[model samples]
Target: MSTALNWLSALDHPEFLADRVSAALRQWPDGDAEAVQVAEIDPAIADTSALVAATDITLESSANCLVVRARRSGTETLAAVLVLATTKADINTAIRKTLGARKCSFMSMDAAVEATGMEYGGITPIGLPQDWPLLIDERVVAQDQIVIGSGVRRSKVRMPGPLAQQLPGAQVITDLAVPIA
Candidate 1:
């Protein structure tokens, strides 16, 4: 954990973590030392741009989790995609091909919240449904640290970049996200 930032142990802030995030952290290997730090923030600033402006974090160090839906032959596949705030997921091309779906789009806010059981604007990849693939942009894994959602709107989770690779069903994909000009 970085000594510069004020970070609370994930174990100490159940109220700030989504139920699934808390449970996952509890089971994470202690030897991995990549401890996830929870930091309380105003819900109003939970969005990436606002969060960066309001806190010490930077836009490059913040990752956004988005729920993408793909449909094929009446079967719907939902995936949780994590991308750095400075880029956008290539949903129309890369993700669509990976999902093997003819159509793909961002999941509706209502459906995303209902399926993840997390608040809108606070969906982290940690507690996603087991069946859903967790697509992590390669750029995100290259960072030393990042701030991500805590499954709720009042807090954020900070952890080592490599730690995201340990997430269930997580797949690091190059070009998963395209840089934004």
Candidate 2:
């Protein structure tokens, strides 16, 4: 069990996790899933700011997984961007260039939900579509533990930050985001 998540309980209710997220955790090669903990919460507090205020998790230890669209030559692709709660992904510059797209921007809630089969505000990198690139900021990977979406707004997942790199298609990129002042 992760010592950092003393504030959270073990997986009390498996139903709290999204289907894909549960599967992903169970597939962890090192049994790292055993170290993960989850907590059920009101959907209203599932968003980052409210989650921080409603629980012991701090902003620094929380990560936000966003869905962004990359478009080039009329072709559109979707990718997941994971950044620390205190930073915003540099979508227009860094991401667009990295994705080799003429345009890159956050995807609409409806599109993201339909594409990922995860509720908005709870789309985690753990269960993203394999074809969809999952970009993780260096800062987020540096955290000891991170609280992120559980694929459902009713709960959240907390795991060692580095575990994010282990996701099937995750790519650790430097300067993926800029600190929010």
Identify the candidate with maximal lDDT: 1
Off by over 4 Å in 1: 1-5
Q: Where does model 2 exceed 4 Å of error? A: 1-12
Residue 76 of model 1, lDDT score = 89
| lDDT tens readout by residue for model 1, 1-181 | 2113368977777778989888877777985434788888889988988787767888899999999999999998989999999999999998998889999999899999998999998899887887899999999999999899999999899988889998889999999999999
Model 1 clash pairs? none
Can you write out model 2's per-residue Cα lDDT over 1-181, one digit (the tens) per residue?
A: 1113233533445687888888777677656777788887889988998878767789999999999999999999889999999998999998888899998889899999998899999999987888888889999989999999989998888889998988887999999999999
TM-scores of all candidate predictions against the true structure: 0.94, 0.92
For candidate 1, the lDDT comes to 0.88
RMSD in Å for all candidates: 2.8, 3.4
